[model samples]
Target: MTKTVETPREREAALLIKAAASLQNIRDTWPQDFDQLSKALTFNRKLWTIFMSSAAMEDSPLPHQTRQNIVNLGLFILNQTRELTMEPQPQKLDGIININRQIAAGLRAMPA
Candidate 1:
């Protein structure tokens, strides 16, 4: 049988699944060093937020509105991701983690 091509929504869902898997891997392979653990956590949280946002965009009813919202949200997520990747500061990590957790929880509660 020939392989089927994925639509944009399917591709987005695949990406989200990959990101979630990576997050779990990081959690499982937690580093003993405090700095390393912090970095891993920060990176995982950022990926999770992106994944959730992308999934949300996929599930949105109004395609144009969702695209616009994703563009705005994408900018914010990119800025935050940049900050997280830069210095690995506690405050930044905390903020990102909180937002990621909230988004993930909200997304989980949404009907699939």
Candidate 2:
């Protein structure tokens, strides 16, 4: 058996897409599915936290401006998650879902 190794961008894209799918699924079955909201949001939040931490690292491969942009975007995502957790609205997840999918698509477009 042979295993294919994924580049960092591909891995990140996969994670983001997975998080987005989880959020989207929760959104689809919301309130009745409220029990799952915290789990989904927590996973998404932790993923963004890891991204922010990596982007903030001094030795990160990303350029300073790009790293800063990622940190800022991560902050926005964190805030969005906080708001969603507080309110538990299905519509509130739209922006987060769009951002995740868009970022994932961009990551997937990058050359290895």
Candidate 3:
């Protein structure tokens, strides 16, 4: 049997999906797993930071509107991450998961 290597967008989509799953797991555990939740959120924040930086690059191949949208989403994620860190609620992870999953789905649907 042979394994197929994923392309850049596929890899990114997979990461986003994994991040969403992590948040969902944290949500399922509720307030019982602060340590895991914190780590998951930190990972998500780092991922978003990379995405935001990529979107901000002048040489990025993405369309202007797409870049702007990514920036807006990154801002939302940053603010939500801060809120989640401060309040530490299971429900707080929901929006982040949704956004991540949605973006991941979109990326997956794009033509290669």
Ranking by lDDT: 3, 2, 1
lDDT of candidate 2 over 4-109, digit per residue (tens) = 9999899999999999999899889876887888898999999999999999999999999989999999999999998987877899999989999999999999
Instruction: Name model 3 segments beyond 4 Å from true.
Output: 1-3
Residue 15 lDDT (model 2): 97
Residues 1-112, candidate 1: write the lDDT tens digits. Answer: 9998765545444544544444344444543333454445555555656644664675656476645765565566557667756654444544444444554555555555
Residue 92 displacement (Å), model 1: 0.7
lDDT of each: 0.52, 0.92, 0.92
User: Which is the better candidate, 1 or 2, if ranked by lDDT?
Assistant: 2
Candidate no. 1 TM-score: 0.45
Model 1 regions lying over 4 Å from their true place = 1-34, 37-62
Off by over 4 Å in 2: none
Lowest lDDT 10-residue stretch of candidate 1: 26-35
lDDT of 3 by residue, 2-36 (tens): 99999999999999999999999889988677679
RMSD in angstroms, candidate 1? 6.8
Whole-model lDDT for model 1 versus the true structure?
Answer: 0.52
